[model samples]
Target: SLILTESRSYWLASLTFLLLFSLMSFRSNKRLILTSAFILLTAGAVISQVPVLKDRFHSITDTKNNGSNITRLMIWKSHIKAFTEDYTLTERIFGAGDNASKLAWRHFGRAFQEVTGKEEIPPPGELRKWFHGGETHNLYLKFLTKYGILGLLGYLFFWIYVIYRNLERRDSLFIKAFVAGYVGFLVASFFENNFTDAEVQFTLFFILGVNFALISETAVRQR
Candidate 1:
């Protein structure tokens, strides 16, 4: 019995082609490659924005019953206040560990009450709670709260190394594509904790590790 089965093969294939095209664009003046990549990205973005597509996507992931947009907006507003209150040198450097949620809740609770003027209203449930949901739903913020400044610096270093190596290669299409796709992930991580989930974490680390390994192999072959 196979423990794992690959799902969404079509989507994965599209992403693979997109990554390849993005990388090829870096080393060659190929308009077709760039155009193909742009079309793929635009198609994915447009599909994501459509209500029916969005609903279907959520349903596949079992997130169909998630909170409404208004609730999320309110939570984010409250979260901004909490983050500001807790934004300190110590918190920025050493992080708050697993206790970040409790601290955020206390801070946001006060802010929420003050803003809404509701005395007995209960705090939002698991879906509404930032930490309960496993993070603040932001990768940068999550790193700040969990790993602190030092960790963030280390993380940035890894990315810099990847980009530097890619730039040094004159005709490496794979390197270019990997870096471009990585940048895309970085952008998306700002609004969502894309790295916090186990599945995502594994995939990210696997891709990065493979890219590094490939680069190393190429260097060895050259030597």
Candidate 2:
């Protein structure tokens, strides 16, 4: 499970390598099989230890965040109310921009404090200072508010293109495996704002791009 937590991509990549090695080993390519397995294993081990790297790996898996998780859901519910109050086609498509976060903070913070009976303040030290405005914790909503409907459409389109181009090739098992893992990550992003988190976004895009490249190579070989 820990290994699974480390990286969905790595796990998928390792599986692909193992499958390929198993299939090709019968051809007496002992050295090639050993080299590929060793390299993949080393990479997976090293990546699991790096702080940011590990976060990306874990992002693909669902983590229980205790009770604190509901705050965002509550905030989202409140946001829906605010959006309904306005209910303009313009607001729905273009959004109210940074103002939405402020509105959410005021409503959600007050509610949170009232319910929990705790005064909310920024945390101690640099982290608090850096984040002058508290986070919404929902990347899709954040982008929607900031960039509007057109931006959301463009963003989704880009990912769709990436997935389509990468997974279209049938020749490479590695590409196929990576795409499978990526699809999992994409699904998780709906519930969690995975793209807003730097670590998650980086790992997701990197693997997607890598898979695309692998697929391209395989297509070339088949031609």
Candidate 3:
């Protein structure tokens, strides 16, 4: 799936989740730990041998040549500029409401254009396509742009709260896996709006539900 999507975010996040989960779940099993490490190394070696896949992987850091990377950077820059420059004090604190990043983007973009007769990095129309219902390609920035600092803090708190609840029953491998997957999601969120992606969101929340279920079952067993 990572190769097919050619998503650097997916690759990094999957590796993070797999490594963390394996270490946590098999910490006491030296043989299993060694086996997992070998398997990961073998997979990485095989991936590096594939020309197309190898190039895609390497291109993750090639902002100059990688169109996607460049575009992502530009999107972040433009939206952040919009938020800082065009957004009002109230908007900065509480956001401009849903789907308002585009408004902010356009407002600043057009003003910049009028003053300099030059288009912004993403250009308003091009950015509109990428929105996909308020996706700024970065979850943190997305919240900051549309939901403001308060929203961002709330979102972070929700994740922290869930992770804390799961950790209270740290013996459950299932709960540990849930935490690992969420850590992966947070890493992925740095580069993609995984939270806004419906399929990803569904899977994420479903696992979260199972995490709580496991925690509940353990509590009941203890009682």
Name the top lDDT candidate: 3
The C-alpha stretches of model 1 lying farther than 4 A from their native spots are 1-38, 41-51, 54-80, 87-89, 109-134
Model 1 C-alpha lDDT per residue in residues 72-146, reported as the tens digit of each score: 334455555555676577766777677666566665555445545556556467324433443465677777666
- How many clashes in candidate 3? 0
Worst 10 residues of 1 by lDDT: 1-10
* Tens digits of lDDT, candidate 3, 1-223: 5556767898888888888878787855456467668867876886788888889888888966676665566566667778877788888889877646566455444434443345654555764554444347889998988888999999999999998998898777677778888888899999988898799889878977777888999999999
Clashing pairs in 3: none
Arrange candidates by lDDT, highest first: which order?
3, 1, 2
Q: Model 2 misses residue 85 by how many Å? A: 2.4
Name the TM-score of candidate 2.
0.55
- What candidate 3 gets wrong by more than 4 Å, as runs, is 103-134
Question: Lowest summed lDDT over 10 consecutive residues: which window, candidate 3?
Answer: 108-117
Ranking by TM-score: 3, 1, 2
lDDT of each: 0.61, 0.58, 0.75
TM-score list, all predictions: 0.65, 0.55, 0.83
